[model samples]
Target: MTMQLAIEVDRADDPRLQAYTSIREKDLTSGHGARFIIEGKVTLETALRRGRFKLGSLFLAKSRLEPLADLLAQVPQDVPIYVAPQDVMDAVAGFPMHRGVLACGIKGDIPSPAEFLSQGIRAAAPSTLLMLSDLSNHDNVGACFRNAAAFGADAVLMDAQCCDPLYRKAIRVSSGASLWLPYAHGGTGMDMVNAAKAEGYEVWAMTPRAGARMLGTLRIPEKLAILLGAEGPGLPDALISAARPVRIPMSSGFDSVNVATAGAITLAHVFGQRT
Candidate 1:
């Protein structure tokens, strides 16, 4: 029999519970997987049934444990399954209530840029690549990938300064698309530009400058890399100077769109032209 440890609901107010929550976030940023704090029974059971996410451990209210007995059977016997009083689970998590279950899962490895690029070519018809330059926000990075996937972009390339796409917040914000999308990191923005050129891609930098062709007016090449930069700084002058700078047509008052949003619009335009 699995040893069932019961914790009181009020115990969530204890320092230990607070510590556990803090540690989980820290672990996620450090590329370590932390146990997920699942609320509803349905979500927990569904995740287990899917079998894609590795469940490390589970926590449940004693009353809810029996209802989840069959689900528990699906998990490995050695995985710790704790029973805490409903109130305790709620207090510890700083929530009003938990629908009765939580689980921990192992962190998966992030694929190399080379591996992602190869996979993109194999999977997509005509590869569309989005290269990000020094964008630091994980949310923006993840949103970019999500939009890329949605807009038919084949792969994403990140300069070294971009946030880790696999970071927990990024993954969650991306609605988990970050896991499925092919992406590369560690390469400098320029290195990516060179690689894309070598792969027979025409690099286009999205920038706001005089004499730059409007996005709608320019003819995008069939094989292309759309280069984007951080919000305030935009692309490096050298990069913009080196590649073709294209501007999206915006309303008179608007200065610029969010980089991710701009990426989506450009991707739509380019991919639309291809098909």
Candidate 2:
């Protein structure tokens, strides 16, 4: 029999539940070491299956326990599962407990571009990848991860300024795609372009600048890395110059779409053709 012993905490002040306490009031950069809070059923499921995170504990609303028992059984017995009543959940988290699913886990290292390229995405068949720059919003980053998974992108690379895809809200928004995707973070946008090039990937930078090739007409190579920037300003001139510029078609007077939407469209175009 699988021993799924769930501990019940009656008080909000319990030190064992420190990871779930007053999250809105705390800053992620201050005391958080490698551990991050995971939210929702889908996200926790992916995180558990991926085994990338070292889980600390699971804080679930008492009512949600039965629904999540199958998933809970997959969890190692060494990890504690905490079940709390609705009132206790709300009191501990300082918010209403709706989904009633939550987890605390440790984040592992994200490899750098050179190290990642050493694994040979270039050697693979008709590959696809997304290189993101300065994507400050966690939700957007998460959505891009979802798109990458949907379109079968081999990997995702985020510039130094892009937000962490593992942010609690990002994990929820991604429906756990962020947990499953292989991602690397480091360097500037140009650094990513060059790394992709070094791996023999045909680097294409997506932008709306003058003289850029239309998205529908461009020829995607065997190993392609598409670069996307945050909305509004788009890719920097230096980064844009580092790779071949490509642009998506749009109606007159409408020049932009949300970064995630644009990436998905672009990814769909390339992936759809390959398959």
Top candidate on lDDT is 2
TM-score of 2: 0.93
Per-residue lDDT over 100-185 for candidate 1, one digit per residue giving the tens place of the 0 to 100 score: 56655554554445445544464444668888999988788878987887888877888778877656456656655655666778
Query: How would you encode candidate 2's per-residue C-alpha lDDT over 43-62 as one tens digit per residue?
Result: 88898888466898999999
Off by over 4 Å in 1: 1-120
Which TM-score value belongs to model 1? 0.69
Q: Which ten residues in a row have the lowest lDDT in candidate 1?
A: 30-39
Q: What C-alpha lDDT values do all the predictions have?
A: 0.69, 0.84
Best by TM-score: 2
Q: What is the TM-score of each candidate against the true structure?
A: 0.69, 0.93
